[model samples]
Target chain A: DTAVSQTPKYLVTQMGNDKSIKCEQNLGHDTMYWYKQDSKKFLKIMFSYNNKELIINETVPNRFSPKSPDKAHLNLHINSLELGDSAVYFCASSQRNIREAKNIQYFGAGTRLSVL
Target chain B: TQLLEQSPQFLSIQEGENLTVYCNSSSVFSSLQWYRQEPGEGPVLLVTVVTGGEVKKLKRLTFQFGDARKDSSLHITAAQPGDTGLYLCASPGYSSASKIIFGSGTRLSIRP
Candidate 1:
């Protein structure tokens, strides 16, 4: 069984278009996170959800929204996409205290989004 | 978000060579994690160091935590082609911080 999974491993859309990336975790973790890695290979945290409650929202653009229907899933929606939005989006999950000391995150295969 | 600086943004070495990558930050973190990402794939956790000055080893890989808990290093012994990938360092923000700041990643390539 996959601990974490993301749909549409690759997405290509034109500018001003809207798209969504879906993520799900079967590890029964209480926390889920969305991160974006750009062409520069820099991984940045975009949002975090704890038990379906919004916890951390970085300086991400308003056009990017993360919706958690339940603890098992967290989806990302991008409206009026821009060319700069092209990047690899990754989904991760972890328990409240996933580790004894360091909370380790389990990541799913990333979804590469490309905007023209 | 805390900013992390990783050194030697890109590295290339021959088989059996040894190399080390450093991750530094001004902010203190209770723990720091190391992840390896392959092409077109998500990162996979390699190790996590919680206690300051702690050291851990996995196979030929060695990890060390700074005494101040503000930095860390990853050392690979006898590098191999299989080790080619992106290495990222991330710290689960301060206690109850809610977010993690990941270092810019170091790309390593080993020639067979």
Candidate 2:
């Protein structure tokens, strides 16, 4: 589709449960990122991967882990989730990370996660 | 960590009205970008300002980068109902792109 795509557009689970959200990009970009949008609609960066290598890891909790198997795919895995984890999680990607270029990011439709 | 403070967290205006959203920061950025996000969707990039004091226009929307590269603004002229959405600003600093920071966002509602 030449866009960033994410699966499980909605998720509902209990506390202490584990879940995973998958992401893929057909834009041929090398860098992928995961962002969490809170209830306030604030988008915050969680993790970033470049060419299947982990690059940026924000001050996120250890329970939220992001794994990249290939350049086009990045997955988010959460262990022992809490109620505060409920939010809309988005996946994005970009071409280059160069300072001069500062490549623009393309985002997915987002996965709304709800924990009870 | 760099922080982007967006002004006027919420705004409601009638159609054809004008308003501006501001993003301010204490740290300099290599490039700043503006995005508009609708309900249930991810943010869509509107513009990217690379140079300090640079100005870019997209239709009725205009974006300006601060001369210090630490702030930015998005002004809309004759706004329409379709302009209602959450506007976010992001600043990805340096070559690593690790220090990227996003503004709190401006939620604008344009009534027709």
Candidate 3:
């Protein structure tokens, strides 16, 4: 069984179009995250949800929003996508422990979004 | 802001050659993690180091944490083609809980 899975392994859209990526994890983790990996291979945290509650909101544009209906799912919606939005979007989950401060993330195969 | 800097942004070597990659940060972290990402896939955690001057080994890979808790290193012996991937080091972001900040990554290509 795949621990973490995301839909639409590849997405090709035009500029100004809106798209959404769905993610699900069966690991029963408490925390889920959305990350953007640029061409340089730098993974930047966009948003994080801990047990359906928004926790970390980075400097991402408001066009991108994350929704977690429950502990197992976290989806990302991007409106008016631009050329800069062309990158691999990854969904990850982890069993979080704030006091111990150890987070080992399990990632999905990733969705490659191309904004033309 | 805490930053993890990885050395040798890109490396290409022949199979059977050993290599070592370093992850350094000026800020102290309670723990550090190492992940390897293959093409068209997300990163997978390989190991985590918590204590200062700690070392862990997994098969052919050896992970070492600095005495100051500000640096770490990953060494692979007799690297195979399967070892070709982008290796990243990460730590909990200083600004938020459960936020992991990753290094730029080292892209390793092993040619058979």
* TM-score to native of every candidate shown: 0.95, 0.94, 0.96
The deviation in Å at residue B8 for candidate 1 is 0.6
Q: Score the docking of each candidate (DockQ).
A: 0.59, 0.61, 0.68
TM-score of chain B of 3: 0.95
The 10-residue segment with the lowest total lDDT in model 3 chain A = A95-104
Q: Which stretches of candidate 2 lie over 4 Å from their true place?
A: none
Which residue pairs come into collision in candidate 1? Answer: none
Residue-wise C-alpha lDDT for candidate 3, range A22-73, written one tens digit per residue: 9999999999999999999999999999999999899999999999999999
Per-model C-alpha RMSD: 1.6, 1.6, 1.4
What is the C-alpha local distance difference test score of each model? 0.91, 0.90, 0.93
lDDT of 1 by residue, A7-116 (tens): 88999999999999999999989999999998999998899999999988989999999999999999999999999999999999988664435577889889999999
Q: Scoring model 1 with DockQ, what do you get?
A: 0.59
Interface RMSD of each: 2.2, 2.0, 1.9
What lDDT tens digits, residue by residue, belong to model 1 across residues B1-112? 4388998899999999999999998988788999999997899999989999999999999999999999999999999999999999998766564577789899999999
What is candidate 2's TM-score against the reference? Answer: 0.94
- For model 3, the stretches where C-alpha displacement exceeds 4 angstroms are A99-101, B94-96
The weakest ten consecutive residues by lDDT in model 2 chain B span: B92-101
* Per-residue C-alpha lDDT of model 2 across residues B1-90, encoded as one tens digit per residue: 428899899999999999999999898877898999998888998988989999999999999999999999999999999999999998
Worst 10 residues of 1 chain B by lDDT: B92-101
